[model samples]
Target: IYLPYTGTTIGSFGYVPMEQMEGGKAYAASDLYSLGTTCFHLLTNVHPWDLWKKQGYRWVNSWRKHLKQPVSEQLWWIMDRLLPESYQHRYQSVDQVLEVLEFQSATPANPSQSTSKYHESFLNFLTSLRQNDQLKKQVMMGGVSLLSLGLITQGYGYFRYQTFPSNLSFLIAGLPSSTYLKTTLNGHTNSVRSIAVSPDSQYLVSGSNDHTVKIWDLPKGELVRTLNGHDGNVYSVAITPDGETIASGGDDNTIKIWNLKTGELKNNLTGHQGFISSVAISSDGKTLVSGSYDHTIKVWDLPTGKLKQTLTGETNWVSSVVISPDGKTLVSGNGGNTIRIWDLDTGNLKKTLTGHRDSVVSLIISPDGKTLFSSSLDRNIKIWDLTIGELKNTLTGHIYYVHSLAISPDGKTLVSGSANNTIKVWNVETGELKNTLTGHTNWVSSLAISPDGKTLVSGSRDDSIKLWKLP
Candidate 1:
């Protein structure tokens, strides 16, 4: 479980400062201690305490021989740092610890080689020490001889270290244009702010600032149904994956759930106090998340317009919200330039990511729920390490504010729309700029990709949405 102020310790026993340990006043190293102990448990299915009995407690020993799984050396180093008996010897900061874990070591050691290296080094050093008394002269000669050999070995190793190969990691390649098709539906008087394609891709639903939501017959680009209810601008819209119901939230501080077949409003969720900024329906279709300028995010039951939970504490307006594909976690972005993660079952704040410089306008979680993509008025998109809530990298290319973002179904490509009237696609793994779609005449307001990951649709301030065939 995630703790509040109590820091995480990393050792056989979760040792927090005696004072802070109570009511959970733990140090960050406490997490490290837990990690090390957990590592030991995962490796042997035996608790660290069971390995060695200590004073009314169990301590883990045989630190070198026990852990046999495929783990990075840097992580082992961190585990050691955390399990130190004295806090002074433990990792002082998370950054320092992460640096070691992230440091690209020159070689990927095989388990046998790693074990041999450790044992050989230890034996060599011990042998040299055993001969220390008899002949001080021999000791001096041995020291000089070993020093010269060590320098030569290091110099050669530095110059001959193997260069690791780089390989392209693409999740979804754009479909070849010769075999692809395109279609565009024209109806709304203003720019479309959000679009949701039915699971079968036969129907497309769009909401616009024109205060109307329209459903279009896909592949033919023909208007099918128009649902009108909002009194103000409609900023966002989402359709259930089953293609049965539609949910739209707007500047009116209300969310309306529509029956797709009958074009009837089933329920109007009206608890938000300010403009509705974004909305998302969980994969299970039972929960709906709505974020608003009121600085709170509300989780509601779709079938009954009842409030399930209210997530508050954002210092500024909550601009966007998304639930992971699994529906177990909720992520919300705010004008305070922060991203807060919540546990859906317990309705508790899990983490607060504070790295963005300007208002965070949009957020998209990866399909595997391992990473989060956030766009902000700061003119950059940030990829975050979700598990630890660390900023992995900042992608820069947009000359203006980034408005909307979408990740390809394969998760390798990230497409973002910007106020510069361009949609840029990026290689998410390498942070490389792939291509820029520049057909729009004004600022691009929103973006969407076909389920097959070939066609890209972008809504722009020019009051038109264009279809771009990926190259």
Candidate 2:
């Protein structure tokens, strides 16, 4: 009888008596049904019966049915519990529903508890706004009232501290010194084909020939989760800026997105004519870029799995692709011994970078986009003045083909993995050999640097991924 317009029925927490109440027991199924009704109302901004009138609710009749975008699995699961049909099949107790909502467990607050305090104060402020004119007046007057001055001042201080600066001033300074740190992750069963560090450097993602991507928590050195879907060797993996989703490309000719935390496969994006050799995610994580042996680079709408555009022309395989830190530029290397830069927004070819005598295997761009580094089968890594598309310097020392390359976060150290089974670190400023890391028993296929510029990771054909500490 107490159904308010706010989408919740306070009196019918879970049910109503068949006689006295409008409904029966407030079981899990009944709760689920109510939830579905409530959700439909929230989504369409109309009443549940209104959707039924137009048959729009038919699309949401089952839990398995796919709905429109923006609904997360967690939310979907909650809706199912809230709108079940059968009272017996529905959650019998609030505890059951609470379990699904992850409210079954409780823990003490943190030592500081400032976040808790802030949240409590926020709720009080919101409630007071309705009845306490003193608070409302304070808000209307730019939060300047004697009655609320202290709370307002504290809230303002908290808000100011919580507002992160536009950029970390330290990151703008360029790559930190190469001081190698070691990491240990255990999960992959076969040769690791690729490794990509998260932008924040907190998570490390690796794709393996074993047909899985292993996500690892860094610094602490623990396996977080394994992403499984690809049928063939996983060649590349890229984590979006938000760190909630992971995009992986592989020999399966498909790219799959995974929920990083839940380790669930979101969707399979398929269209490549051949094995996808490389993948990169835009800064916003809304678009995905991939290259394949099919001799094409494709951009995709990450949310809808739609192909945005395809760049074609390579007579040979496209090996590696890197989206510049700014997300506006894309650089791709191909078996044709050339690299091309594209304006991602317009899908227009910006410049063709050429000079390598052999197939270009890998490419990386400095944070500032001022320098481009590429490794090629010609046993050399070349630096380019990206502003003018001119070769700045050719770094040579590897006795065998260079297969993978990575630049330090500061752009001062460049490291390359080679078929010679060695990882070479170089001085970007002087083009001098800094260190030769030897440990791999087979061809080194992929390399990555930690965000702190303190660790280097290399994947080899011997079915092992090793970590090298930089000095």
Worst 10 residues of 2 by lDDT: 164-173
Off by over 4 Å in 1: 1-184
Tens digit of per-residue lDDT, candidate 1, span 1-471: 233244433222333222233344455544444445554465446655544444221132135356444443323334555564333335544434433322222235445534454334433443453445453334232322332233223322221231111111122234432233254456877667887767666777788877898887766777888999987668888888888999999877899999887799999999898778899999999999999877888989988989988887877778889999889999999877789999987889999988777668889988788999999866789999887889999998775569899888788889899765667889999999877666565567777776776667777655676666654
**TM-score of each candidate?**
0.61, 0.61
For residue 51, model 1's alpha carbon misses the true position, in angstroms, by 77
What digit string (tens of lDDT, one per residue) describes model 2 on residues 1-471? 222222333443222212113432233333335544544444445555443446432323332333333443334334543453323223443334433322211223344543556535644544455457665444333311332343333333333233211122222122333234354355676668898777677888889978889888776778888877888779898888887888899877899999887889999988888778899988778889999978899999998889999988666778899888788888999877899988998889889988997678899999787899999866789999987899989997775568898888888888888765667778999998877766565667899887777677788765676766754
lDDT of each: 0.67, 0.67
Error of 2 at 20 (Å): 81
lDDT, candidate 1, at 74: 28
- Number of backbone-clashing residue pairs for each candidate, in the order shown: 14, 17
Name model 2 segments beyond 4 Å from true.
1-186
